[model samples]
Target: MTTPTAKRWEIVDLIANRTVTAGEYKPSIKDYLSELTVKPLTGIPVALAVLYAFWSIFSSFAGALVTDGFMVKLFDNYWLPWIQNVWPNPDSVLYFLFVGDPLADNCFEAFGMLTSGLFVSIGVVLPAIFIFYLMMTILEDSGYLPRLAVLMDGLFHKIGLHGYAIVPAILGLGCNVPAVTATRNLETKKQRFIMMVLLAVFIPCGAQLGIMLDVIPETVGWVMLYLIIGFCLFGFILGKLIPGGNPEILIDIPPYRRPALQNICKKLWVKTKGFFINAIPFVLLGILFVNVLYLLGVIQALADLFAPLFVTWFGVPKETVGPLIAAFLRKDLAVAQLSTIAMTPYQMITAVVLISIYFPCVATFVVMLKEGVKELAAAVGVLAVIVFLYGGLIHLIGILLGVA
Candidate 1:
């Protein structure tokens, strides 16, 4: 072990590193500094969060106007028709294989404006992500996010978490990656693991919420409310069931103040850009995968298998199976797929609930790997079982209550 003097020196070096990189961050670990809260301001942070959510809703509306009015008109009507004219029967087999021609009765459809993942992302996901990042960065910087551990202590206790467990669940809404990173704030390995598991299973992000609205329009709010309740109730139940060390409530409450505009802008730009860079590729690939699977008649096979389940139990169409499967790859795309099928309000509510509780998502799955292979497997198995069980339970209750 290093001598006390050396540890002090090492910590000083670390603080210097943080101050330089984070600009506003001060990560001193000295006894006096350790006692001080890192968060220096607050009210603005919470206001910013509220603003960000609504702002995203507004911006997405504006984006929809632009994409629908200009892009859709230009690409779908003008460009696609010109392409079809030039191709004139586009009857070639290989062409039909890759790009389905409805005219030729080929199953696959070509990558067109209608199926352009990029267009959809621009119209829907980008605005929501940007707003989400802006809100989250403020919460994180102001230190209220840390204080949330304190605020939610009582609530979490009702859920099964020692106060420390609340941190990951809240952060999970911003992004599961950082939420997993924030799990380090938990006091012990067990607390972090359980919290991580819960977050991956129940917490719904704003982006997910946005897509859910578009996919199943009739009962989005009710679905969201139910999902939140499910998250809280199940989390409480699991926390109590698990035999682990009691979680203590210890957080640094930073003073409240107005958020810095410059800081918010800078962080928002970086985060939104980073999100687009990472997610755009995955979305395009998902689109391509769906197209190929549909081309090969694979989607139909699975749809047939699940038609009864979707129509009878969940109250959605068999066609919803593809989107539900896409959810295992990306929740946004899965939700987007829901838009094409018809369903009642009850089905819409159940669909969103099932989607919210269904999977940890691909990104979440990767984060679970950090817990080690065996631990990740156990975590996934438990999550998978719980999601379906809870979904089925909700459906049964709905039926009994005449929810449909």
Candidate 2:
């Protein structure tokens, strides 16, 4: 063999024979699912079905089963009555601050730090977020989220973002605080800013969603329609106006695998822990702050002053001012408060939408500030304009539809 010089082709074939080993390949079900989820033809309907299931489970388990069937009865029938009787001195400032209205029948009407705060945080929001995080974790660990991102990439690009933007958008539905941080995954400053603003304005947190299902279940669909419209409309405008590069990104889609129970439990625990530490305090403090403002006559004064703007422009009542103020601290609490106010169904819809879009909760605002004070300032400015324009636009739509 050494005596005979080998041709280059023969040497190349010898190397290939040693290196490459061909085998029969059979596609697995996981492979078929992966393809079905990423392609446009099949993926869109699958995405719709998945989201519908998500919403259905979130509403039924969190809203109906846990909160309505259990928490409502527990808090309203037993807890509220017991607290009302035992809290001592219903007339005292401390009593009012902690227990709210002396004769109120339910936790939602109580408005006290200890009464409504605990109820809203534990009874309503906790279940909602738990279910949301559970489903979200399942979607994430099963390797479906990346495929969702890929499917959404084309639509998102029209708004100056890649497919990955859906991650933050979905996160925002649970809570905007984490969603603001999630924007770091975006490639450019403009994308982050747009995402932050959109999240702050358009996406209602799980707490709000839970309460909405409880309070305005019939009209929640309309409210959501308006929000989705605003999200895309402003996103497109920002994509055109903002000065930054929207670059393409490479997404690494992992093979489908069974989500490990240990991993899901770990993620769920971490998320629940975050909500307890970051959100519960705010819910309690929000009630306290609003109560103090009420006692100080600030809420009444502001309501009187804003009566013209709120009534004339937003097509909502001046009383919405109080809830709007509370909204700064917690939008869910504000929505709950809004339910107590007297308004036409249309006005109620507008007021709730206003509360949803007006400003990010203090927690979200703080996180945005941490991202960059300058960015925060700019976001606030954009928010102000969006509130004015979009609020008026909704009112205008209502007027055209004869609903305002």
Candidate 3:
């Protein structure tokens, strides 16, 4: 027996009749706000306000209330002293590695696996990342992120990314490991590579941001300004250079809703737990590794060897070599190490910016590698070029301003 096949229009009409229903739609406040957030006229100012609030809350709660107000005092006054006094033989290798400088009064200068490591990871970074994740969770759960992405689509396309590229960029601010993975959401290999390279080089993780605020609050703004400029400039250049299809953005904008407390707490817990498991060990190990390098005279030799280039080209002290090494493991640790170095404010700014742009932390590197080895190599090559060119450009600007 032969079955009769419905015509294409008839099939579509049958499906529509069975699945679609007509109803009177009434727009609510949520609809109005969603439209407002995606429109250029209203969205830009709202975005600015949202970002300003995010920064203010981040700096105030994490930097001021928690780290500066609580954790710093506890670690510096109590923990450092107790560990220093109890640990045997201040000159002993173990003591130096574990407890750091016995005479050092603060945790920041202690530079031990236990002292500075714990302080940097817990005291500074923990609070910063906790608050960051909390706010990020709220933004995500409330359905603001996609709308923000829509609003940013136009600018993102200028750099060869769609609006959704903001997902990885924002996530990169927390940790580039996840951000590197988040790039998988992009449509093209070119988009993923550019986003990975840009985030790895320019977006300072929350841990690093916390340390920057604590260590170089005066010049952190300058460092961020340089980073932003580099991100846009290099992103634009790479977009044009890399052969790829720059497809138009297609995204679903969900209606804004009240974020659930349960979901927010769960996400916060997951992210915080990941940070504790992954980041703390790296911070501690980075301190230990750098200390061992110092003991073996590797750092000193590197400083001496690189002094000419650092002084002339980068216009910063070569002592930055130590922090650069630490930066490979954990950038927050690197920034903490940088704080102990003696440099002028401009030099400090330059060194911090260099540390940020020089390379991704080991975790980020691993994730990028997971994406593709050839891509990783290409990204690294691009990174090397950026470091030399952008670092020199910054130095030239500083020289013109008589600051370098």
Candidate 4:
């Protein structure tokens, strides 16, 4: 037995019938990797590099290649044409529902279930979702997420959130529904609400980001930059307004291990299936809503009603009213619809930014309500103010930069 001592070391006497000698243990490769990847100063740059690589691969390579080169072209050249051919009558209600106008160059302009819905849901967004989740799952399993969170703890504390809040924020990039639910891990309602607000206002879900990549590839980085700046700025401001003390982060940093391929695939499948099941139905419903509203001529009416706010203030076209209405159902679908309009990259960016901040999808809204009605109401008020002010602010920025 060793006795307590004031010094760092205490020696214990060992008694055994037979003497035994053991070889010394040597450090493994993971031990060396951690020194660079998880240490304080080096960890930050390495994390940024990993993130940059992730964005480049997911957005520029896989998303562009699989979505634009293969899926969109497949739908435009074969699937959409076949549907249009089968239902040649443009005036038929069935044709309107499934095919929209047969004369449109591609499914994007067609705005129907078989056309726009299929293209946006399966063709444009699905591939990106697949790739994004694949990478996310890999990171999650490899145990690097906590180290990255630690690197971000100082910055997060400045905004009244501890490092652990990064989990929900990262999850928000995949989908806000789960992200909102993940907030339960937070200690206080104020922290949860603040996190929820920041997610709803700034983080672009994978599907929405996919459409943005397809439509505004050249400036997607700039769009993300603007959103991140807004996220940090608003988070700090909201922290000051909301009453909450940020608790210090206490987290376990797991040892890094090689991620198994089977596990990654299974996790990807579960997440992708959830997204497909929830999001695809809403996309089809969005197409139906658009067709019915356009048929009733109510779309134009609503466009007129909101013309001053959307058209004049936001500097986007009146035609965006349909997409804005559709945003409540599925934001990615709304972003897809915006791509069909003949707007400059700046106008498109303005609409994208507004939709990002305006409100969560209907499912997320219900979750917020369940969390607390009063809190939800206050969140709504904050959303509205930010949407209008930021919407106008981005437009002014566009003009100054001459992109609008």
Write one digit per residue (lDDT tens) for candidate 3, span 232-262: 9999999999998888888887778899999
- Residues 1-404 of candidate 2 have per-residue lDDT tens digits of 54335677688899999999989988999999999999999999999999999999999998899999999999999999998998888899999999999989999999899899999999999999999999999999999999999999999999999999999999999999989999998999999999999999999999999999988888898899999999999999999999999888678999999999999999999999999999999999999999999999999999999889998889998999999999999999999999999888888889989999999999999999999999999999999999999999999999999989
How far residue 162's Cα lies from its native spot in candidate 2, in Å, is 1.1
Superposition TM-score, candidate 3 onto the true structure: 0.96
**Residue by residue across 1-404, what tens digits does model 4's lDDT show?**
54466232422223332355677978888888777776768988898899988888888655768987788789888988788777766789888878887788788888888798988888877887888888889889998988888888888888888888888988888888888888888887778888988888898888888888887777677778879988888889888989867888888888998899999988998999998888889888888887888889898999999999887789999899888888888888888777778887778778788778877988688878888899889989998988888888888888898877
Best TM-score among the predictions, by candidate number: 3
What number of clashing residue pairs does each candidate have, in the order they appear? 5, 0, 0, 0
lDDT per model vs. reference: 0.64, 0.94, 0.93, 0.83
What TM-score does candidate 1 reach? 0.75
Off by over 4 Å in 4: 1-28
lDDT (Cα, 0-100) at 260 in candidate 4: 94
1 or 2, greater by lDDT: 2
Q: Pick the candidate with the highest lDDT.
A: 2
Error of 1 at 202 (Å): 2.1
Give the winner by TM-score: 1 or 4. 4
- Name the lDDT value of residue 45 in candidate 1: 59
Each candidate: RMSD: 8.0, 3.5, 1.9, 4.0
